[model samples]
Target: MDRITTQAPALVLRPWDPADAVDLVGLCQDPALRRWTNTPVDDEAGAVRWIQEQQRGRAAGHRFAFAIVESRATSSEGRLAGHMVLKNVTPGGASAEVGYWTAAHARGRGVASRALRALTDWAFTTFAGDGLARLELLHQVDNAASCRVAQKSGYELATLLPAAPPAFPRDGHLHIRSRSAQVSALVDATRR
Candidate 1:
């Protein structure tokens, strides 16, 4: 497993830990987040479980979850700004789905977009050996903010998926980003 630690000018993307459970609880309490994700992290135990589940998923090669931390100089430095993940990874790593949520305070600061971009870059660069070829992001049809994030992260709106069972039980938009030709060329050059 790759220990991913990607940094941007304003944020850092690292693995989520047990120490982040408290912050996760608070983030889950935000009504807007709840409405979007339908997560079960309303309390400490749930938050712990969330962290544990992410670890398990990573160990199983099913997902890679990250904590979005801001690079600040104040006491709140390193606070949990949000969560981002590459989930529903297919066997053989041909593709994966990206998902994210911003904490209430991080909502308008472009945290989600920046972290997502960093995560996408890392995934493409690190997972080519595992056969990763593309990544996808999906959001409810009415989620304009998420749409903007997808666009900012270089994912193109591919299609509209009708309300389906389980994960997306509502109409949604699918966004996709394939491993770019430049990256593929670079990989080939390195191989030679």
Candidate 2:
């Protein structure tokens, strides 16, 4: 698959490149980032492997992972601000899971929520003809910031999920944002 480059008012989201391994390693260094999500990127080698996984996932059309950067970035090489992915998509599937994380430098600045909105918009636009109906975003119960991001992205809390030990160590919230709901919310947001 060709690389995807998406944009929002404040962001430019492109495919994860091997060149971003250094930035990934640095972003993964934040304890809060590590504690909130599980991506297994602790070092440069891990970062490279993770990036390859993203590439492979894209090739397989099972996931679309994006490296988020500022649209008007200061550096020639846009500083990596965050990451987002639409994972677990099956061919002509009705739903897909979305996940994201923001670097410490970008936290509390609406990066996650805005990038997620961009990704969600892209997913629905790109996959709707394939029967995509909704996006699911899950996060551990303790992740208040994540919960906020979900809400801001117009995903409503749908259900509670039990902890799956070793993988999901805590109870989680499953949020759902359907295409109809997203359209309404987006229209409302634009109106406001």
Candidate 3:
């Protein structure tokens, strides 16, 4: 494992690296990520492209993505357990939306919750000097796990933004969860 970045009791969240392409490909291949996020690469070339784009996105400051690494009882340090990507970030920017997926082998172990909390905390403070007001998670209403993550991350149900599904066979309903006064309260309560 590389040096721990955003450390909690058992996990570390750090920026994505170009060298992480292979593991990232494997991470994206998890069925859960495929169902919720954009499709994973089917070939090495595609994975390479995705990794390059992520690197570019990071350099351009248009988006930020991090790997969620965790320590296991058997491992001395931490290992990449998942990924978290935050898009459209700017100080006092209208809003930043977060997306994440846990590794297939690391699900249901509080990894997502811990990472989300850390990410949200960073988002909240990143724009404190500016007028940045809130963060949001635009989730498909049917994705209960993500809804839980959003809730745990200090977002409250703000509104529903409706749309059509990509395949056109299904209706798309987008639920928007926003960080508001309640989130401030959550921050106060959770901050040590």
Off by over 4 Å in 1: 1-8, 74-77, 181-192
In terms of lDDT, the best-performing candidate is 2
Number of the top-ranking candidate, with TM-score as the measure: 2
Superposed by TM-score, candidate 3 places the C-alpha of residue 96 at a distance from the truth, in angstroms, of 1.5
> What is the C-alpha lDDT profile of model 3 across 1-192, one tens digit per residue?
222344545777677666667777777777777777774576667777876776687787667777787866677446679877777877557677777788888787778878877776666656545655666676676778877777765566776656456732233333343456636667787996
Per-model CA lDDT versus the true structure = 0.83, 0.87, 0.68
> Candidate 2 — which residues are off by over 4 angstroms?
1-9, 73-77, 186-192
Over 112-153, each residue of candidate 2 has an lDDT whose tens digit, in order, gives 888888888889988988999989999999999999999998
Q: What is the C-alpha RMSD of each candidate to the true structure, in Å?
A: 3.9, 2.4, 3.7
Q: Look at candidate 2 and give me any clashing residue pairs.
A: none
| Each model's backbone clash number | 0, 0, 1
Q: Of the pair 1 and 3, which is ahead by lDDT?
A: 1
* TM-score, structure 1 vs. true: 0.87
